[model samples]
Target: MLEATIPVKHKVGLHARPASLFVQTAAKFSSAIKVKNLSANGNFVDAKSIIMVLTLGVMKDHEIVIQTEGADADAALAALKSLIESNFGES
Candidate 1:
């Protein structure tokens, strides 16, 4: 498993649209992806689960914990980090 810390770049955080985009990106990978907030409740959320992400209610500057396990973990992490860094293309 590989893990990384990313801050929410979207002004409104991972809402419906951004969460949907995140789920779509995560689904493209063959690895198992999980997202969490260490500062929140410390529970991991399914990266491809829209409802789970929506429940997080992440906001800008919020730190997100990402984990992936699989052969393509590095690539998956890079792509996911880029996606989040781009504010889900809202930036």
Candidate 2:
């Protein structure tokens, strides 16, 4: 498994459009991906599920840990880390 912690920089965090983009990105990979809201001391949730991700209540400046496993784990981790680091394109 591969994992990384990143802080969300989007003004709205992972809500609405950002959340959708995140889920969409995760869906592109076949690897299993999970995200935990470290800022909220939250549990891991399905990265590919909009509902599960939304439930994370990830606000701006919140730190999240992304974990991925399976054949594309490295790629999946990189993609997700890039997404968040890019502020979900909200910048």
Give me the candidate number with maximum TM-score: 2
Query: Using alpha carbons, what is the TM-score of model 2?
Result: 0.96
RMSD of 1: 1.2
Which predicted model would earn the best lDDT? 2
The C-alpha TM-scores of every prediction are 0.91, 0.96
lDDT by residue (45-76, candidate 2, tens digit) is 99999999999999999999999999999999
Task: Tell me the deviation in Å of residue 42 in model 2.
Answer: 2.1
- Which stretches in model 1 have alpha-carbon errors above 4 Å? none
Clashes of 1: 0
TM-score of predicted structure 1? 0.91
